[model samples]
Target: MLDNPQLTQTVEQLTAVIRLTVPVSEISHVMGPAIAEIMAAIANQGVDIIGPCFSYHYKRPSEIFDFEVGFPISRAITSIGRVKNSNLPVVKVARTIYHGGYDGLAKAWGEFCAWIETKSLNPQESLWECYLVGPESGPDASKWQTELNRPLND
Candidate 1:
């Protein structure tokens, strides 16, 4: 939904973050609620289809192999003693939209793969998720907007 190359940096950053990962099947069942809470707190408060998404780098090793479903953000923060989805210093990324359901995220990642290869770009060591919806709007996959991004490292 956004296209601003200057927003991403040319250099990669090395930082630690608290990331929550889930399978495609669990997105609506799990992350849906969690994201709703966060989205409600943000402006617009609407779930934007931001598009098919996949992670090339995790916020941390712990998050990489985690199945912390049904865990509220507060509980996860309390248990881990940190926030999982906050922004940290990261390398700039070339962002895009891969319109489709959660299952199509793989194809979105493929687009990033293509960008990296075709543009001769390297990962900057950081990525991000921007939710354009929240509980106010309710769960409607068609209205779900997710921004699939790839940080390019120089």
Candidate 2:
């Protein structure tokens, strides 16, 4: 489900975001509005999105997890409602590209984490996924591309 797993550095990004802590079952419901609100705010402010949308997970999965859905912006801007300015730190990560629907993401993450363990890599709880291609691109779930990034311990 994932390809070319490797250790890599994520470029630091300035973003506009909306953050929340939600159960695994509620992620889709929460993220959809949060993403739309962020995007609309950015558009209203006339800022250009510098990169794809990212969902940063601040805790390992359990009954609930902290997550932020946002887009990289060219420059920091004023906060709008729940949308706020944030920064993505430059960090080493175990990264891989998953080509499938979002539903299979847990399997991809499991495989990536196993790969990290095999390499004896120490990982942090924080992780992020960049959606490269999504529903906006097409309806084919098989073609959706997501970059899964697990941060490494410093």
Candidate 3:
């Protein structure tokens, strides 16, 4: 489900994001459109996208998902429509790459959290997933990779 998890640190990054607090069932319906709107705004401002699309969840999800979808940018950008300037702050994290389709994410995260527990690591409530390779990359779901990151508390 995922590669060997590793402890690592992330560099802070600037981004243009669209914040959404939607029901779990509504996530798929909103993801595409939110990403497109953010991309269009970034393109209009001529901001260089430095990373793939990612979702930064503000808390552990249950009936609702409060998160921001966006891409890391080279520099700051002005707010446009639903898109606004935001950032991924530097933090210590437990990171791994989930090798499968999106439907397998929950299982992957479950397995990952188990590993963290085994290692006695303290994890924060927030988490993020970077869509490294997905539907746009190819037709084979097995080849898709999603980078899962769970920030750790010191």
Candidate 4:
């Protein structure tokens, strides 16, 4: 289950990502290679990653999801291969943490959306999820944690 949502400000982030429009079912398949490539490219460029990976969704899920899978960098770097450089705007957001496996993310998102509706908040189309702990941390899905952030209109 997710905790109650809270409004917070996030720092602007410099990231390296591979953008794609993929069906929800194929997100894992697409993201896996993209993440590997981006991470490897960043390493090759001698760039340091400052945070866990994230997925920035540009549109709500339907038959397809328009998103970018990437990592935050310590400094801006040149793009390499399919890995392009981008920035996440520093803005006010509704935040919530999901403590579970990826399978439970949809439920968490639904609950967060309901909370937003109840508060009469205007959410932007874009949202991002930071993977605080995941496979790299361990095989225990129950121990994973992800932070979801939805930008709110001023």
Candidate 5:
């Protein structure tokens, strides 16, 4: 019964957040390491309500993203302070909800981007991430609710 939920593109003013991240052009190879580092840190520090975090790229100089990975902050994100201090504008984003585990996240991302194309949306060069929901709240990916966001039609 689970299928793609309707998506919406809107402007958002997110609250301040802290995170530690490394940029790797190869998303697939790097995703495992990123999750591992965050999980390891969570194991030691305990998860906190750090809010949603995203990585972005843009087609233009304006603040916008083409794709994003959403992760609910489970630990204190003190590492992102340096970035926020830069006073940068966040990429404009489009959001959709999905039901499944993170293993299929890449596929979900592909679908989202495809949807963007069909809907006449233009992807920015900037990538973005969103924390629609967390698997921690559910036992399995089938029961997980994830929110995927992409920067488009800006």
Candidate 6:
């Protein structure tokens, strides 16, 4: 379930990311390796990971998922392989937290968008998910938390 969403402003954040455009079915397959690659690259540069990992999607997912998987970093790093310097843009967004397993994300997003529509908010083409706690935390899926942000044009 998602917490009540609120409007807020986000500061631009520096990040290290690997961009990918793959079939929707391939998201689960690609996510793990992409996250691993990002973490490895960040470690190679001795950069401090300042925040939890996140996926910045360029558009709502359909047949294709085009997005960046990475972590917020203290400073920028030179590009290495697929890992590159990127920034989470500053924008106004309607944000909420979802507490559950990753498998419930699609449903969570549907609910979130429905709320946005009820408020007559104009959302951008993009959105993002910040993974606060997941598999690494424990075996309990009920305790997992993900922060969901949908950029708004208003």
Give the higher-TM-score candidate: 4 or 5: 4
What are the clashing pairs of model 4?
none
Scored by lDDT, model 4 comes in at 0.90
Give per-residue CA lDDT, model 1, range 59-122, as digits (tens).
3213143422121122112222332333234456677654444555555556665666777677
The reply for model 6, stretches above 4 Å from the true place, is: none
C-alpha lDDT of residue 64 in model 6 = 97
lDDT of each: 0.42, 0.90, 0.95, 0.90, 0.49, 0.95
Whose TM-score is higher: candidate 1's or candidate 6's?
6
lDDT by residue for model 3 (28-74), tens: 99999999999999999998999999999999778999999999999
lDDT of 3 at 101: 95
Lowest lDDT sum, 10 consecutive residues, model 2, at 59-68
Task: State residue 2's C-alpha deviation in candidate 5, in Å.
Answer: 7.4
User: Compared with the true structure, what per-residue lDDT tens digits does model 5 show for residues 68-116?
Assistant: 2333443333443122211114555666776777677667777877777
TM-score between model 3 and native? 0.98
* Cα RMSD (angstroms) for every candidate in the order listed: 8.3, 1.0, 0.6, 0.9, 6.8, 0.7
Flag clash pairs in model 2. Answer: none
Question: Stretches of candidate 5 above 4 Å error?
Answer: 1-92
lDDT of 1 at 58: 51
lDDT of 4 by residue, 24-137 (tens): 889878888999999899998899999999999997666889988899998777877788998788989999999999999998999998899899999998999999999889
- Model 6, CA-based lDDT: 0.95
> What TM-score would every model get versus the actual structure?
0.49, 0.96, 0.98, 0.96, 0.52, 0.98
